[model samples]
Target: MSFNITDEEVKKLEDVASQVRRDILRMVHGCGSGHPGGALGCTDLLVALYFKEMTHNPEFSMDGKDEDLFFLSNGHISAVLYSTLARAGYFPVPELATHRKINSRLQGHPATEEGLPGIRMASGSLGQGLSVAAGAAQTKKLNGDDKFVYVLMGDGEQQEGQIWEAAMYAPHNKVDNLIGFVDYNNAQIDGSTDEVLNLLDLGAKYKAFGWHVITCEKGNDMKTVLETIQEAKAASKQGTPVMVLLKTEMGHPIDFMVGTHKWHGQAPNDEQLASALGQVKETLGDY
Candidate 1:
């Protein structure tokens, strides 16, 4: 099922996002380790996708023949994906408590070994998701499945050489059914993406690779994100892959963590968690 964007639905998604943010902080704090910055930054995009945009089934499948598929290339942000999947009904929400715990399906990085319901693949390795997504998109084309394939990558991941290779491959093969997004929050584990490795004119780079490119300057704004996604969907299926550069803030909405790399992979302390939780209302009930 896909979400139709209405005023109420947008508010519903915003509520879900608030809950997901709570989940992210709690999961990381529970484990004493996990990436929170990128996860928080991308919550709105994933919430928008599973709750409002993509035609997907929470009833799990490996082959994903008929429904749209999504891959999390920047797999370190597993908190957001796990929380989103659980909130979306692929699994129970309370399982979030087992996050990063041994033998739990909700590992730190998504893994297929446990046969997690919403996870399509294990993807902690940087810059590999787009390649997998391109292949999946081509598979759907060969099978005549009209559903689209979606992938989310980190802007820091753009530094990986494999990303450039896949970037070139998708357009050359005309994988228009695949839509990719880069969480361009400008911050990474070490520091800012510009401080680490500058991805100069990322949208232009994607366009030069022959893909249709879109930009969302306010990725944290749910309405803007939903509208930008709508625009991306309209541009898809023409002949080339689509890429959306979502300009988001790392550790968004959390005052202490916003716009910095300090929280990229750090968990909040008891006091910090308390403060962070205080910021987002416990919408949809916390796990």
Candidate 2:
């Protein structure tokens, strides 16, 4: 279950990603608390990273050793991370039902206090993960480990001063082993990023900070996500940090949920749940 998805494994990943989306819907609906829009939109990217790209061991260690490390800066989207970790064999998939429940290991945002196998640090506050990832990447380099460090952040989070601070620091410190991605879906909690606070020219901004920038115009598409990740990895060693602008819709998969900020943190009602799940086929058994 922890194998990288080669050409023959692509369909298997698609099946598992559908199931992950289903888990996202059910987890948020069951708890009546979660941010599903971003989770749904970023599913393909998570699937590609966990199932096909990164070299990770779900046997779960604090120190990643030679494995590629991933940090989720936009922790509001824990549903996708938890489900993807489960399907990737980090833990039993059935444990997904415990999400957001009292004393559940799967906190609303990922936490290390719960001893979750896949989580490395406690994250919920924005703009901190990139700094942590930069430190981790530097540690890896010190240890002579050539593996890359990956981090995901939301489009709106770019407004945080700390993000730019880290953005400016990574290249200055030559954090070349770090590959950071922004979910440039253009939607946030209050409203669309443009309506709330516009993040214009994300690629140019990263490049201006002395980092190598790549673009994925179709982040929702599996092929495009996979190919772009490889492209990022290929460019990771060019004496500068790498940034990927992963463009996606706020709400995806579900017809009603798609292209709207209304569903960003709202739970679906019974009618909406059925309508949403109808679009994503249950490929793996539901939790």
Question: Which 10 residues in a row give candidate 1 its minimum summed lDDT?
Answer: 1-10
In candidate 1, how many Å is residue 102 off? 1.5
Clashing pairs in 2: none
Q: Candidate 2 lDDT, tens digit per residue, 156-227?
A: 899999999999999998999999999998888898889898887878889899999999999988877888
Cα lDDT computed for each candidate against the true fold: 0.93, 0.91
Task: Look at candidate 1 and tell me the lDDT of residue 231.
Answer: 85
Candidate 1, residues 1-287, lDDT tens digits: the string is: 24347899889999999999999999999999999999999999999999988888899989887998999999999999999999999999999999999879998899999988999889998989999999999999999999989999999999999999999999999999999999999988788888899988999999999999999999999999999888888889999889999999989899999968899999999999999999998999988
